[model samples]
Target chain A: MALTGLFLCTFLLVHLIGNLQLFKADGGMAFNVYAVFMTTNPLIKFTSYGLYAIIIFHAFWGLYLVSENKKARPVAYAMVDGKANSQWTSRWMGVLGTIILAFIVMHMAGFWAKYKFGEVPYVQYERNIVDGSMTYGPSAPIESKKEQFVSAETGMEYTIVKDLYTEVAVAFKEWWIVLLYVLAMAAVSFHLVHGFSSAFQTLGVHHSKYNGLIKFVGIWVFGIIVPILFAAMPVYFFIQ
Target chain B: MKITLKVWRQKNTNTSGQFETYKLDHVSEDMSFLEMFDVLNEQLINEGKEPVVFDHDCREGICGMCSMYINGRPHGPKHGVTTCQLHMRSFKDGDIIVVEPWRAAAFPVLKDLSVDRSSFDRIMSAGGFVSVNAGNAQDANNLPIGKEIADEAFMSAACIGCGACVAACKNASAMLFVSAKVSQLALLPQGQPEAKRRAIAMVNQMDAEGFGACTNTGACSAECPKEISLSNIARLNREYLSASFTAQVD
Candidate 1:
């Protein structure tokens, strides 16, 4: 679970970076384009599928362990002391994980689902002939027009290029939404701060000197990058 | 000097605990923190009251038995020292301090300011030992280990099995403790044969003990009386991974 959780944390950095494109000046097209590129790319597609598997496995195993721990200690400790003994994040993994899960679900529903399954109007194009000739004539004028189709059932006009990325920006760029993202990311960072190094230990990869290097990398990858990437999106939009 | 102390008191492991406040007067500044507690206990005995119960042995700080949380910090505001080594001079005459036992699901409190740290012993029992045959002492010159490795092993082995690392961690993780033991042996040739089993058994025991995971916050080392490095935890990780892989391949 720690290994998978740490891996998910690494994925969050890349995911957040791609999500940051929503804050670009170009409404949501830049982010939408980036999203399209990500979803359609074969390598990214494989990684995304892997990410889904990791999340499920991590969450399920984490839940299993938590329940097992709870069962181990049916009663609370008597001393009720030692608040200084452990890291804040270590004690609060379950809470942080739940928050991250909530945010992820909302995120997927708002952007991913919309882009994949939401109905959109098809693009229409028109070409005009010049000088009543099949081919273009000298000094002949040519005309071109574009149109959008509206849904007959819903009576709503929607563009095929509906910027789902723009919708995400509108939702997440709000102060509260951005704050939620930041808070969730902070929890993620804390979770990673411990999870990353601990995963290697649990997996039994101790090597004295190199272990220190791996821990340093864990801090950089999880503690720094995850929060920064998630924070970037809100900052990008809020700055302007 | 007089100081106010709010010490955690609980009837037993099954009962809820609370901070019971007590005051000590004319405590000597030169006296150690435990000495201050001695004064309080003396007063309690004189008053026909049950004195606070806490763990301490080799009050000189060699034994990791002296564990407590003082004023939201381990070892009562002093850095790099055990609870027994903390002196009253670090506080003012009228300071109000809060004292508590190590809080974790794994380390249950036995009574007032005392917790059962046998979980640590269990973890050690799982994988902390070397598999050496029973025989007479070998000649010192028989096995020639380099000075550097020997020194490193000694440093790692210096950990006194104190639960301070667990208390100092926000998650109450025993990573530092487990790492220290694992690294101490893994560094030496004597511990090579059972290194794989040791790593797996120790980690499994740690998990079984319900200790929280390490978060690489470095808090454990900071609060460790011996100042055991966080690098030990890393070494434990590497050892566990390599051992598990080797075991799988075999």
Candidate 2:
């Protein structure tokens, strides 16, 4: 569970980096190009399969651990001040994880699945000319060649490209969607607060000298900083 | 002082338990928690009723036989003290004190507040002792253990085999108890020979005993009568991982 959780943590950072491209002021050209690159890159595509497997395994393993824990105490105490014994997040990791799992399902369905299979509307950026040959559009120049161009795949003169950036922007423009993203990111933060250093301890990397430092980073950096940055993305787009 | 007691009462291992409340007046402030229970038991005995049954060996806090969860804490609200050592001064007049047995599947209540703690003994017996042969006491200087290492080991060794760590755990995990024993042995030169075997054996026993995995909550240490550090749990993790990797050669 620890190894898989850490793997997911790394993936979060990479995903955050990719998503940050949406904030660029290039009329969605750069962001869409990056999104296409992420989807098409063979290496990333293969790793994405592994990522999916890890996420599912992490969730199930967590479920198994929690079920076994529940069995450890068959009789419930009449009065329990659980806060006296442990942190709220430590006790409710399963609940937070389930929330994140639900969020992941909705998130992928809303964005990833739509980008892949849903009918995403398209925009036509002006094609550029460099060195006497037609090249991809540039951010600064907004001119398209007047000559009619035919596409083999659709068999039509392509007037537009897939406008995934606008899809994201439109989604964020709704206050409810942004609210959901913020709430889900809050769950992610709580999950990481326990999971970050917990994975190291589970994998037996707890050094006498470095253990405290690891926990510090787990609670402070991963728990606080990463979640804030992630939540900020939607808020940034909503205002924009 | 006047106080209200909500103590768990169970007939036997086969019967379900419930709380029975008893109000007491003129309670002394200096009376230990156990003494207050004794007063209650005296009242029950005077009324020709079966008194509450609980476990206690060395009331001064050394022998970890005492098991009770008072007011949502393993050993009442006091830190670094057993239930027997806790004084009534910690409570106020007209206080409501709720006490129960250690709640764990592995620790079924035999009767009243007494639960079976043989699960701890089983885990301990799996590998808690060194294999040194019987002989006259060796010279104290022979070990040559550094002061820091000796202090660390002694701290871990202070674990009195109490079930408070287990009771205090949300998952009913025995990690603190098991880890304290492991950490004590893992730190000493006498315990080095069988270190790998001991780690694996004890941890496997802990798992088989239906204890939950440690999620590093630090509650055990907080409520520990001995105040055993959570670092011991970390050391146990390290030791177990090391043993699993090198067990083939051993």
Predictions' DockQ, in order = 0.21, 0.59
Model 2 Cα lDDT, one tens digit per residue, B81-138? 9999999999999999999999998898999999999999999899998888736767
lDDT of 2 at B169: 89
**Candidate 2 lDDT, tens digit per residue, A16-132?**
888788777767766777777788789999999999999999998999989989999899998886787678887788999999999999999999999888877656554332222
- Point to the candidate with the largest DockQ: 2
DockQ (C-alpha) of model 2? 0.59
Q: State the iRMSD of every prediction, in order shown.
A: 5.0, 1.4
Question: What is the overall TM-score of model 1 with all chains considered together?
Answer: 0.76
Question: Can you write out model 1's per-residue Cα lDDT over B7-105, one digit (the tens) per residue?
Answer: 888999998878789988889999999988989999999999999998998999898888888877678677779989999989998998888787778
Score every model by TM-score: 0.76, 0.92
Clashing pairs in 2: A123-A161
